[model samples]
Target chain A: MLPPALSDKQTVPFDDRGLAYGDGLFETVLLRAGAPVLWRYHTDRLAKGCRRLNIPLPCQAALDATWQGDCTAELEVLKLILTRGSGGRGYAQPDEVTPRLLSRRTPFQPSIQRWQQGVTVRLCDLRLSRQPRLAGIKHLNRLENVLARQEWSDAAIAEGLLADSEGRVIEATSMNIFWLQAGQVFTPLVDQCGVAGTLRAGLIDQGVVAQRALLLDRLAEVERLWVANSVQGVWPVTTLLAADGSLLQRWAVSDSDPFQRLAHQLLGFA
Target chain B: MLPPALSDKQTVPFDDRGLAYGDGLFETVLLRAGAPVLWRYHTDRLAKGCRRLNIPLPCQAALDATWQGDCTAELEVLKLILTRGSGGRGYAQPDEVTPRLLSRRTPFQPSIQRWQQGVTVRLCDLRLSRQPRLAGIKHLNRLENVLARQEWSDAAIAEGLLADSEGRVIEATSMNIFWLQAGQVFTPLVDQCGVAGTLRAGLIDQGVVAQRALLLDRLAEVERLWVANSVQGVWPVTTLLAADGSLLQRWAVSDSDPFQRLAHQLLGFA
Candidate 1:
């Protein structure tokens, strides 16, 4: 269901920075029980991204109303997009910036069974370029991710992993990845590239895992793995393959693992 | 005028990857005397960029028709945007991709006096994040450029220069910058960041200038400075300032430079 605030939409101005240059940031969160999870984190990231882009963040009340009321669905995916409003035909943004805040709800959720059974994964040919300045932030300039996700479509393949130019395994196309190596848990350090996922944050903050750069050459050493995003919560990777397209490892994080237990507790999956 | 092609205008599907994630490449060239200046270079770069992003290059027939009826004006700016067409709601792109090419003409010609007197420039506080994969290519993920351009409203300031996270000077908001330092021309290498501008390439190809990484500290010491873009041709800089809100040196290239003369000849400037 489309959010009420966005129901009376007109044509997004041709000069909008978002359309002209992808000059914007967006956050997608799982809406359970008709309430957006981690609303604070999503809003904070949106504001921080706006500040970095020199766009003034919009009002919180207005934003909350846009996402809050008139939603009948209990489970949905809520997407928030904030763009530097229209201006000069060229890239130069207008002096008086009018920001656009939009919210929409879609009745969508990943199959719970898939998360439990673990999903197949592939290694994408496209690499996420290292951009420390833009890394760890969920901005709208996601062509790299788009290309990475496009690499495979077999229903058997659930997600694709991307690496940096230096062959450091960064993250999956849409989720933060964690691998259990030598009984230690680690996820890629997003300081150089990849989004600092909200769910990843909760897991890390809860002392379940550490963040470090994962070199692609060492993929064979990992014993178990899983991916997390705001929407998917936690999905075990049943299989990981080598770049030469050979099986590397398979993983199943039982609900018994302390980390998995923590994830379930934090995500309300418990 | 909107192209008659608009009558049946097939453009980005509502969910175009380009529009959603800025997964695309674009080229804007000057159409004068009924021919596109630097057409081959523009098309070559576009094809290379498409390959980098894994999007199929447009067909020759589509390319020809993109600009055929357009550019009717005696002189105009012809812009062509090619995007990975629709689908893939998330980061994943569709298995089969249809690239959308939109061509339009804009009436634009920089004033002769502005080029002669030189334009004012300011350093942008918004540093461009370095993403080498997208560097040197004219892709649509240009939020940094948009933010830098939004910094000030002083009409006198014609352009803003940006640096990367490490404080290395990159490029101007909308153009490539070149300066003569110690009797050798230098432009920041785009390997770490920034676009490899078409006009900048022309100047280097014609053996009129040299190119290299330029430090922000060295910019003030340059004997002369100029900025170039496909649409703006070239313009000398009379003033320079750092993003720290400090004044740098000012410079204006002599009108007698062979490159300036060539620009005048090619652009039909008096």
Candidate 2:
């Protein structure tokens, strides 16, 4: 059969293993200036996820073609999903598996307000499960994040920070986190758990950020903190709150923060 | 829409949360002689799962109607899926969430031989993550099971047993496991991990089986072991092998195995 028309998101069979078992990987790309921002980092992570999950990566054309739509919007979101295809005998994957790809574009509602003024973050009571094999890969098994995200509905709270089962601060509900302490920047190691965001990877790749085993207690000790992802850029977290809404730490976000400037330089964004 | 026709599985949107982030729950029930076996157990689990995930469960009419059809085949499998219906701002659930239901039926090929002449089982290297909130829900986030099931291709091996990250034996890739020792029956506690099977519940609820924390190393000490589920019935396990095919334990399954007899009476299978 021909590849689905660029618009038919209906091609995914209800039996697609992604729907059946979440046997898939996904990448939400920032399509700015008609091209995906940090495309290579997204590709690298997707490839790594596919390799780890044993789901074949789609051909380069199929991957590239997902973002070929009109560039009318300066900034948009490209949500890409690739599953271990339509047929599988229960949890036993098909012997000859073909991966299915689905992409959806939504207008990017830039969180510049959150980025400029910074945002209040909360400590989620729900801790993330540790699965090193499934960690770092943006696989579809994200109930932990969903549950954590639902912890608070207060509009002022922009993100919820998650800790691993062992009390190690992992990441925010939707983004990877990095903190500066005495001039050195560090993000939690995703090898044990958590999605390693493309922006986080770009920073690590550029040697500006380092990954370390970050315990939850260390969050209170950090000088400055920020949450970031491929779609929303960098969000300086000015306030941290306990689940009970008690104050933990508060900081003044600078307009010319070093990480924000570096992130802008890497993505070539205004 | 009128809750989809009993047959239109296609109504599941491609972006349904189940497919997007494993945000769903499922139950596979046994349809024997035009009726579902252990129906109440399945319903109880489904309701519990939906409540925990905050996915709205369909009313009695919609839930019951999913299986309103001719069950010509004496023994068949009914796969029921309930996903948090489409559309949400990423992982933050929609304020008003309606769940989508999908059911499919296939002939249940009874593993008489595996049941009568105990089948061999293998240990899996892929350890399950510990998430108490997700434990026992039988949610759609099942990549761990898929990965474990893929570990072996030997048709001789009927199942693979899984251990949680804490090195505790949780369950088989597709079934819950029970063992007999000194005339006492025990199964693993699924409070930290594993799907608590309907059949396992039947045994436990009957007060015939005891639940305890079973570690991976303890499996070798059992006198007789069996893996069971609602659809496949009960299969006596004769030999257990490590992931690398090293022998761990073996047992002579009896025609008058006490657990098998009780399970048969509980399931009411001829």
Candidate 3:
């Protein structure tokens, strides 16, 4: 089903609660092979987020009208943004409100080489604060991501992983993190913090990776690591380094590993 | 001096960093008579935030444009939104870009009774995380405030105060706070977290309040308490209660107190 369609033509008032307070949720979908990749999952997640944020779900008819149809080209991305309609200047939201939905298309092509060659990452000095209420959903409060992305200048560092206040590894700046431990794949739990990435959910659904509470002291034991997101797929980590320029860990994806095969199969890589 | 005039037909790209990643800074100015209140301080804070976030600072002409219009309707509110502008789909911003500046107008009327009569407050269950980098600036990453405001449905609670992970009172959801103790006023230090409110600075500048690290344990000793922001001015807190209905403290501003006079004089309250 297509998500609700919205544009400047829609009567979204300037006083939108979303614009005033960022009280909204959004999802980015991979438009591959002329359709939104895993659209059902994306919409389901958006629905769940709306439920959590107390936003009424939009009708399927309204949602279907959002598709641009020009997205038949491969390597395209679609984003759906939803927010509670305008309220007065105050924080108190109105009871009866129409949700604003906006959609847009973008051209994107994931680099298969980056996944196979393995990317380098650095540790961000900034730490994520624990917030159980707003955690796990792809809500718009992302100052932390913006700050972490600004931590490094070298184009070589592909991503920056963040830690919570207690020094526990949470996730990468824009993606979820997974590492090999005791011959099993483990990713951080998103209960108290962090977004539940769609790709991470796919991996966990396939029983390829398990969730665990990671400790800062366990970094030394992480053998091979990878970060996953819907857009980037899964990328291998070549070298992990601290902000002080000390090497932490490095890894290469085994060609015969299940994760590598799954990734290659999903992305159509030989 | 009036700020420069803004482009009336300017449109923000859907992929703008401000929309996608909340990478932006903002200032809410309270207009008195025909001009903005505390314009210099707001601009200074915005400039500081831009420097910290590595966003481009607007030129004098562009800055002046934010307030170069008629604003005489008894009371008015102006929001200056400065964004890093639009870019391709990635966290890494493009080089050689001009930040987008949008200034919008709102209606506001000062309620001195809310300030003088003292407002009721509730302790929010949501805690502000300590992020020293983005702590003081009124940047767009405000999921905490949105959630804190959602914690209460009572209009009687003018503001909800938040605490840090360690259970120390930080500030109200959108304002800075001060508590009177032993004929001295103390406000929490925002070096590690919380916004450095313009009104808070004015109070400190006028020698009516002192800045210090405040703890939750010290609330019981406060003889009077108040919250201040650019828009709300100074509001006395007559009763403070936690989320679980526990009494934290009681405060009031005596009609004859010198501090009350100072607040009225500083805020231009009648």
Task: Highest lDDT: give the candidate number.
Answer: 2
Candidate 1 lDDT by residue in tens digits, A138-246: 8878877876765676778878888887899989988889988778889988887888888887778778889888888787578887877878877788888654567
For model 2, how does the per-residue alpha-carbon lDDT over A140-245 read when each residue is reduced to its tens digit? 9999998898899998999999999999999999999999988989899999889989999999989999988788887888989999887888889899999999
Residue A114 Cα positional deviation in candidate 2, in Å, after optimal superposition: 1.3
Q: Which residue window of length 10 is worst by lDDT in model 3 chain B?
A: B1-10
Interface root mean square deviation of every model, in Å?
A: 3.2, 1.3, 2.8
Question: Which 10-residue window of candidate 3 chain A scores lowest in summed lDDT?
Answer: A1-10
Q: lDDT value for candidate 3?
A: 0.76
Which pairs clash (backbone N, Cα, C closer than 3 Å) in model 1? none
Model 2: CA > 4 A from native: A1-11, B1-11
Q: DockQ rank, highest first?
A: 2, 3, 1
Q: Over all chains combined, what TM-score does candidate 3 have?
A: 0.92
Error of model 2, residue A119, in angstroms = 0.2
Candidates ranked by lDDT, best first?
2, 3, 1
Q: List the global CA lDDT of all models.
A: 0.73, 0.86, 0.76
Interface Cα RMSD of candidate 1: 3.2
Measured against the native two-chain assembly using Cα atoms, what DockQ does each of the candidate structures obtain, in the order listed?
0.44, 0.76, 0.44
lDDT of 1 by residue, B161-202 (tens): 888877788888888888777666667888878998777777
TM-score of chain A of each: 0.91, 0.95, 0.91
